[model samples]
Target: MPGKTKRSGDLATALAALAGLSYLPPVAAAPLTFASPPAEIAKAVLDDEPGTVAVGIWRNQQGRFALQRNPVGSVGEVVEDDSAHAQPLFEIGSISKVFTGLLLAQAVERGDLSLDDTLGKLLEAKATLKPETAAITLRQLVTHSACLPREPQDFPGYGTPNPFSRHDRWKIYAGLSGMTLEHAPPCGAAYSNLGMGLVGQLLSDHYAKPWDVLVRENITGPLGMRDTMQYLGRQASRLATGYQHEALQGPWDFDALSGAGALRSTAPDLLLLARALMAGRAGPLGPAAERALTPLGYFRGDEIGYAILIRGPAGHRTYHHDGLTGGYRTLLAFAPDTQEAVAILASNSHASPVKVLTGITASRYPIAPATQMAPAPAALAEYGGVYQADKDTSFTFVAQDGKLYRRSTGTGFRALSPGGPDTFVDADAGARYVFSREAGEIVRVDYYLGDSGFGGFSSFSGVAGLRTKEAAPPVAVVSLDTQLDYAGHYRARRIIRTDLDLDVRAENGQLGVRAGNWFRRPVFPVAGKPDRFAYENGRSQLQFERDAAGHVAGVVLYENGVIRLRRLP
Candidate 1:
C-alpha cells in the first residue's frame, strides 16, 4: 500500500509536464542486441509479468535468439494484438520433464531400460505400484528419488473437463494402483509431478507407444522439433494461447499429465533440447544423459535440487527446472562447469521464469559475486540449530542481528531474504536457500523448492493474513436468519471418505466451497467480532466449530492442511 508519495508540489507539477514531452524521445528497439532483445528488456522480461504473453530467450549451442510478444497479452485468439508478429506456442510445462528425462535416458541407452530397473519389473496387468513402491528405481524415476505417491488417490477425480481423456489414462493409472507412502526412496529431493508422470508412464508402457507417440518418436521427431508436440488441441496451429492476470486463455492439454505437465515447445524447440542437454554431445542423452544431470537432494532447507532435466545454475551447482500448467511458465538451465545453457518460454501463468532465469543468468553470465566472508561469530551458534524438513515438518533459524532470522519457522519467521553470501529467499518465490560453508562455517543448508511442487497455499508466503502480527480473528456477523440459511446448495461428504461431491454454497452474503474444482471464496465480516473467517482465495482461514447448540459443528481448516470438516446430515 505504500504508493502515495508525490507531493513536492505534485512532483514539481509532474516534472513540469515531463519537461515538455521530453523533446519527443519515443523511439526505442535497438539496444538489446545479444542477438536482438532490448524491446524494453523484452517488455520488462515478458510483459511485466502479470500473466505474460510470449517470451522466449535461448542462448548458445546454436539456437541463439530472443523472441517476443505482448501487445495486450493472450496467446490463442491472438490478442497479442500484433505485439510484433506474435507466434505463441508454449505449454512446455515440466519442460516435459526434459522429455521424461530423455525418455529415461533413451531406455538407459538402449539396453532397453535399467537404471537399476524395478517397480517390481514394470507392471500393467493386475497392475500395482505400491509395495513400498516396488523398490523404486529407473534411477529413482529420473532422479525425483522415486518416493512415489506425489499424486494418485484419484487426485480429486481429476477435475475432468476432458483432463486428457483416454478414459483419463485409465483413471490415472487406476488411481496409481491405490496410493500410500509420502517419503522414502532418496527421500530428500521431493519434486515429483507424480515423478515425471511415471516417466511418461514408463515410457508409454515400455514403448508399446503412446505417450504422445513416444514423445513424437523418441523426442520430437529426432529434434527437428517443428513446433514440437504432445497436443494442445493437436498443436492448436502453433499454439500459445494462455494468460492469467485474471483471464484470457488457450493451450492447456495435459493428456494424462502428459509425462508431467505436457510439452508443446518453440523457443526454437527448447534450443534443440538445450543444445542436446548441454552437449554431452549428440541427442537422446549419452554419457547417461550426462549422468542424469547430476543433482538430487536438498529437497528442502534452502529449497532447490533434483538433477535430471536441470535447473538454475549447475556445476558450481544450480541446475534448474520449472513449468506450470493453466497458462504455461517454463525455465530450464545448465551450468555444468559453465558450458552454460538456458531456456525461458512463457505465455503466462504469472510468468516468473525463475526471475526470468535468474535475471538472465545474471545478465548473460557474469557470476563472480561471492566474496563476503568475515561474518561468523563462533559459527553463529551453529547457525542456531533446529532444521527438520520432514517428520511433521520443522524450521527455525534465529541467529539474530548477526543475520539469519527465520524464527517461528512453523509458518511465521519468513525473514531469510538475501540471494548470495550463502543464498536465501523462500516461502516459495520458487524457493531457495544455500549455505554449506565450513572453514568459515555454516556447514550445510540447501533448501531449493524450485523446479516446482511442494506447493500448496502460496501467495508465495508473505505470511498470509499476517499470521502472528497477533489479534485478527473476530469478525463473523451472520444472523439475517443465519445469513439466509448459509445461502443454498450444500452437498457435503468427500473429505476423503471418498465418493466425491462436497459443493456447499451461499453467495452474496458469501460462504462458497466446491471441492473438486477446488473452490473456496468466503471471507466477509470485516469489522466486528463474531466467529472469524477468511479465504477470498488466499490467506485461507476459517473458524466455525460450534456445538453447545450454537449449530455449526464443523470446520477448522487452517491453511495448508488442518482440514477438519464433519457437520454432515
Candidate 2:
C-alpha cells in the first residue's frame, strides 16, 4: 500500500514483507520516478492505475467524479490533466441487472405489480406459458430464483458480440412452453440472466411501453439521470472506446434481454443511483429503493436484496454489484449506514476497478502486477479449506507453495496469486478473496466475482462454508458397444432454434455429443446413472428417451430444466 508519504522503495519492501521472510525480486529494473500520490485517493492516485478509469465518490451528500487513462506500467509522478474533461459514457454491463431489479421494486411500491404475482397473471394476455412456468412469481425473477437457465442457449455462441440480441418478446414468450418443473420454483437462488430479462419484459408490458421507456418513466426520469439510457443514438461519440485485452471491441446492444444488461452510463450518473439507494425512504424511489435493498435470502456467501449483494451486519451493510461485458467492466457500491458510495467504470475489459473502490474506502490498495513471494509453508496452510455458494455453488482451496489454489469440484487445484494481506486473486474467474483473522488465527475468508446473477461477496467464516471432504473418484465408463448404441442424430422436437439439435457419435469408440451448431463436446456418464450422460463439465446432461419397444426415440437435455429432442430415423 502506498500512502501519500510512502516512497516507492518502501512499497517494494512492504510487498516483500507480505510473504513473511521471503525475498522478492524487483518488478522493474529501476523504480519509475513519479510525483507523490494525493493524501487521499484524489485524481492523482486514480491516474496511477492502468487503462481508462472513471470513478464517482459520494460522501456526506457531496459527489466527486474523476477519470484517468494511462497505459499499464506507464504511471509516474506526472498526472495526466484529464480531470477537467467531461466524463465519457461506458457500457455498464450486468449493473443493468440492478436497475432491472429496482424497476420491479418500483412497480411493487406503485401497486401495479406484486412480488407474489404469478407469471401466468402477468402474461396471460401477452403469451402462452406452461403450467409450471406460469406459477413463477415476480419476486423469483427479481431474486434470480425463478429456476430459469443462466441464459438462452439459442445464440450464435458465447464469443459472439451481442449474444442476447437474438432474444425478443416472441422467444421469451415461446421459451416458457418448454419449461419442465423438475425442481420446485425459486430454485436455490442461482444466478439467471433469463429470469431478470423476463422481469423486464413483464414490467414493460404492464406499463404499456417499451422496457427502456418504462425504466425512464419510473426511475431515471424521477432521479434526473439523463445520461443513463438504453440507446446511445447521437451520444455515440461520448461513449468511450471499450477494449478486451489489446484489441478494441465494439459496444453491445440487446432486444428483450436489454433488461438484463443493456444500459450504459457515466460514473457520475451511477453515483446518482447510489444516492437514491442510500437515501432509502427519503429518496424519490424511497419505498422501492428500501424494498430493493432488503436482505431476502443468501446468494453465494452473503445476503441478497433484489439484484444487489449486501455485506456487513445490520445498519452498517454495504450493497454492491459488478457488471462485466466483453469490452467494459463496472462496479457500483453504496452503504446506507454511512451514506458512502463508489461507482467505477473502466474502459478496458481487464481493469479491476474494485481495487480503486476498495483502495479509496478501506485505504488498502493492492500490489500491482499482483504476483508475490510465497509465505512460509506454515503460514500457507491456514488458507486451505472448502467453500460453498448459492446452495449449488462450491469449491475447495488448497494452500501450497505460498499460493492458495481452487477448483469447482475440489480437486485439480489451480494456483491463485496473492494480492495483498490475506487476499487472493483469481484472474480467470475475475474475483478477489480476502481472509479475516481473530486472535492471530484465520477465522473467515470472503470473495466476490462478476457473473450473470447477483451473488454478493461470499464469506466463509473459518472453514464453515469449505469444511468438506475431497471429491469422489471418477465414475467408471460403460462398455464401448453401449456407447455406440446411443450414437445418432438427435433433433429437437419442439425447441424452435438452430442451436437445438445434437449429433452423438463414437470417435475412437468414445461417445461425443455435438450440441447445436458448436463443435462436438465429450460426454461423461453420471455415477450410478447408466443411461444418462453429462457434458460441458456437467453443467448440462443428456438422458436418452425411449419408447415401450425399448428403442431410443429421443434424448432429453438437462440444463436448468429438460428440453426434449427426437432421434432422426
Candidate number of the best lDDT: 2
C-alpha lDDT score of every prediction, in listed order: 0.49, 0.63
Q: Provide the lowest-lDDT 10-residue window in model 2.
A: 19-28
Q: What lDDT score is found at residue 67 in candidate 2? A: 60
lDDT (10s digit) by residue, model 2, range 437-522: 77886655555442102232324311223334444223424556888779898886563644477879764334677554333445
Best by TM-score: 2
TM-scores of the models, in the order given: 0.27, 0.62
Candidate 1 ranges beyond 4 A from true positions: 1-93, 97-132, 135-186, 190-194, 197-228, 231-262, 266-343, 346-569
Off by over 4 Å in 2: 1-51, 71-85, 356-393, 399-569
How far residue 422's Cα lies from its native spot in candidate 2, in Å, is 17
